[model samples]
Target: MKLISQPGPKTDFSMLLLFTIVVLTMPIWLAPIGAGYPDLVQKFAIYGLFATGFNILFGLTGYLSFGHAAFLGVGSYTAVWSFKLLGMNPVPAVLLAIVTSAIFALLIGYISLRRTGIYFSILTLAFAQMCYQLAYSVLTPITNGETGLRVLQSDPRILDGVITSQTEDGGPLITNFFGIDMTKTWETNIFGIDVQLNAGFYFCAFFLILGSYIAMRIFRSPFGMMLRGVKTNQNRMNYTGVNTRPYTLAAFVISGAYAGLAGALLCVTDPLAGAERMFWTASGEVVLMVILGGAGTLMGPMLGAGIIKYFENILSAFNKSTLEGMLGFLPENMLDGTISVLSLFVGEGWHLTLGLLFMVVVIFLPGGLVEGAKSILLKLTGGGSKKSASAQAAE
Candidate 1:
């Protein structure tokens, strides 16, 4: 009976600005505290983009797609193709990838949109599985089969005037961008800590910032409101003479483009596109990210992506030495067999921790980490006065 007004441009932009400061400065702040934990920086950057785009679709339109990794794989393969057939300018590669993903989303959306709810999810899942299998078999020449598509010493450098990849020295291959070699690292002091920065991290960070900004803008747009309406009540939206197909299709395409951008960033950072990325599980993980961070919240999915990626990269990186160090406070004699027992749960089996976290989030914080944060803030800040009583569903 009552509609809550969305934030004005001023409030929306203020929120966006706050998020921008946190994202851009987080690496700098956490760099020293985390002991050079930049390895996951690009992963967060790419997956954050993926989850943000996903929010546009699942978060806004309430379409729970289980096969979104198809778009990511398509974008990555497209980028790798650009590197192989076109050039390494990055612009063309990225554009081609986005377009490829858009086309795929259009096709999938046209077909899948015909169904609703579980049917839609299943349709998308089937398409994604088909893509995974095709990449593994039907497109061996392009996809390179199970081994995955990768840069090779003999692969043609179409963008380069020369025929091969070169090195710093003229005698060897050159893997570079413009005149700048990408294989080098830049060491800088930040907060009295040595930071070994690299071009790839910066490149991915640019896209992450750009993607987050765009998502924030979309969240504030009138069209975004319509999508949220569609999400809240599609049947009513249709009864109100609104064409839900076009809106849902648009959401799908935009989300697809986001996934594509993330994929291009992935290839740019690693210079490879693997079939494993297309796995159905990969698609499911993005869904987990959105849920983990609280769907329909601007910063939630990014936070969710950061949490999972941190666990995957950082927690998974821990091994015997880490366990021993952690248990060192105890007597050395008591520390024996502790790491081996711990190894069963972590180290290589770190996904167990992720699963437990997801379960906890679902059970205790049904709205996910963002809801948990709000509740904690409500308790800690002695209740936030600026906070809205109504939950803001990010479009």
Candidate 2:
């Protein structure tokens, strides 16, 4: 297969700039939607990074892995341990998490990449489940079992002890960047709306931007072209005396590192690590995020992550009382009937709504939201004619 042409530096800069603006301004734009809260926005950044990393493997190389959550969990555990044994400086925790996760990914990818297709997917799922079980039961000493891992006052924080004073009241230490507490927020009134610009959210957003730039560079690199070739026809490349295994393995490792960074960010904000993060469901959720946002595209995964998180945080907050207030103008009987049906799709039933949305996207917009959006833009701008002209000329 021929190598894909790389995008120009100017194009890359413009795209990166636009992406940065969009992410940094999320609080301002999302305030009206009732999703401007710091915690939820932090989740948006963390999971967006997770899905973006997963896309490097699944999107580029067509490798469907079900064990990425294992790496994420590992990153979190490592970061928390860094806090317990080392210090609360997020820089070292993040760096150590990435390195440790990369190593884990290397070992896992080495074995898992031996198989292809369904077998590979099954192997990943099995490995992730094994990790979850170990963290939950077998590795109780390290993971703290179901109780999860957290920084404790009793733990020996050698680095913190050397540089900082002990807490006067002996409370658990909070994670921070150079003594800038992550949990602190700057709140203001924006056009009658309460907007909170959080330190932790900005911290995650910085990494998200960095990760996106790295992913973009990889996507436009020779290595990325090789990965796309592996996805298109591994056997053909093999026939040409090329070893595709290393390429796929490298992609897997890089993707794992991205996941690791995300997990570390999670701990940086919350300072806790749990086996639940390694569950198969978490892996599956990232897959959905990548697909829903449009795999193989730069902005798709982040968009998907935002949508899913919004639904999780906002839609799932609805209750019978909330619905009654929203529909109070209707007749009592009709309102009750409406609540009965709608209630089944919101709150605890939000998954049903997500599933329905997934089905609609898969059946009608196979390219996901990205494709749906492109189609709409093409129609509005009469861009279809330009695309047709190019195709006809090529033919």
Candidate 3:
């Protein structure tokens, strides 16, 4: 397996530029597009973090954990409880979420790692389901059942440094900045559009960039190579005097922490911790993101997360009226049926689109979009050097 190396100056420089552009200007692009803009991007960032962390276990360590939602739920609950009891100081809540998630992972991993493959997966899934039941019934007072948790004015905002509320006029009563109120709308001109830029979005974007950077580094490290080795051959690794158990456990814990961080970030945006996020489907969806993007690739999971979340939020928003507007250019006889056909794969039934994508990807392109991109790059570069071909053949 390969280890992390310096991304060449050009690649590193390009990544820096890309980060600056996206993190700085996403608000501008998302604002005019509709309210879905900020929230959609936020979902991508958070889920990307979640998927990247999951990849550390499933992609690198070859451990399929189906109960990861337990950590996400744990994180979400921890953060929400922090807001409820401690205060709305986001930093503590985020940190507590990470720590709480880690503890859960450590405990769960210790037991689940005893078995490998399907048994391990089933164990994790059972444990997660156990947590779900506990939250639903046993932990009613803490989890607050189906209603979840929400912010209230009566709640203390200690460490909030500065807090603001929506005004009667429908504008922010106090502008969001570094604990400072601008008392003015937060925006600047962008391409003749009044972009509603705000500090909160930028703050979350910063975590997105940080999370991406961290994942990139992990993908390139010696520990990463060892994890990959475990994925490839746990038995072989053990015989070679390299213990795979701790490595696998570490990967699981780290992934759980990432999910926790994402859960906390989600709360920061909406300030609500919904129990529904703990559902197993949410865990499976993140796994889909990793598989779609190309497991074991740095950018693949993030790209996958973005694509799936985009479809969920943006594509699913399409309705009959919107379809009719576009189809107005077509002949009336052709319009209705065509729109109906398209609707089966999108809008309210968008999961059908996702399922199909997953099927096609698994059957035809097992390595996923990143692998597909690599194949194209290889073809463009003329089938690699003779020495490289020989080396690959040897492998």
Candidate 4:
């Protein structure tokens, strides 16, 4: 028997350096891109982590679980409960979120992994819908129904010994890291552009980088190779006496832990947990993020998350006036006609635009944005080296 040692830190310096630069300079680059707002920035980090985790199972193991959001919702519910009954600091809340979500994932994974293919996907989806229905109805006692669970001013924090959630100024106390309030934001004008940097965004960014690093390690590990084998040919692995179910289940639980952490971060940012977060559509959004950004690639999830969120937040916010200002250089008649047609794809019709974009990516760039970009770059550089390089890298 041979033991496989985990790779050393030095093996991943490039990955660490890349993410470090990106995370630290977000306030600089993200502002120009219309996603620098603290709230949106936090979403990018949270959903990026969520998609990255999902890729671990779906990308590597080829086992798509639509119930992953169930774990995320469970994490949010647990975190809020921790804050409500335990303490105001986010540490315990986040820890409890991970633990509870992991347990939930374990149970769901156990049942769903009993089958494969579309059957597996259906089982996961059914489990997620059941969880959502229960949370919205039967579990309303704990989940707080459709109104969502939130931090209240009168709840007792038995662990922290603080009786009320009010400050001397009479506003409700916000979630914090020790003494630093997670909601605190630092605003400044940089090169004539406004940048809103929040403590909570940085906190989420830290976890995103940490999660990405962990994922990169997994991608380069023997366990990840086995999972890939399961994806590529599970029958061959089974013929060789490999218990692929355990491998897939481990991947599923690991991904759920990541989703749980992401969910906890969401609550840490806003101190609220809604049953809507567990809906199957939320799971589908992460799936689209993973697919749009390049599932198997390390940076794909982040890119996909940013792009999808950009469309959802920034593009959807554009009104007729904003559109007119941007296209004012055109003839008034032409502009009116263009806006009339474009109006259906922005704002209230943003889903149409999103659907179009998804279709474009799926049809023309099946490997997602990363692979498409790689192909374009390779073409500019000239030749067959791109295919050979990608094939070699995959191997």
> For model 4, how does the per-residue alpha-carbon lDDT over 1-395 read when each residue is reduced to its tens digit?
12234457685786689788888678768899788889888888999999999999999999988888998999899989998888778889888898988888989999999999999999999999999999998999999999999877677756654533435455876887777789999988989999888999888898899899899989998899999899999999999789999999999999999999999999987889999999999989999999999978878988999888989999899888888988989997799999888888889888899899889999999989997897778667875565667667778
How do all models score by TM-score? Answer: 0.88, 0.93, 0.87, 0.92
RMSD of 4: 4.1
Strongest candidate by lDDT = 2
lDDT values for all models: 0.81, 0.91, 0.77, 0.87
For model 4, what is the alpha-carbon lDDT of residue 139?
92
After superposition, the stretches of candidate 2 with alpha carbons farther than 4 Å from their true spots are 1-7, 161-166, 328-334, 385-395
Q: Per-residue error at 327 for model 2, in Å?
A: 3.6
Which order, best to worst by lDDT?
2, 4, 1, 3
TM accuracy, model 1? 0.88
> Candidate 4: lDDT of 342?
84
* Model 2: per-residue Cα lDDT at residue 328: 93
- Number of clashing residue pairs in every model? 8, 0, 1, 0
Q: List RMSD in Å for every model shown.
A: 4.0, 2.8, 4.0, 4.1
Which stretches in model 1 have alpha-carbon errors above 4 Å? 1-7, 33-38, 152-158, 162-175, 331-343, 381-395
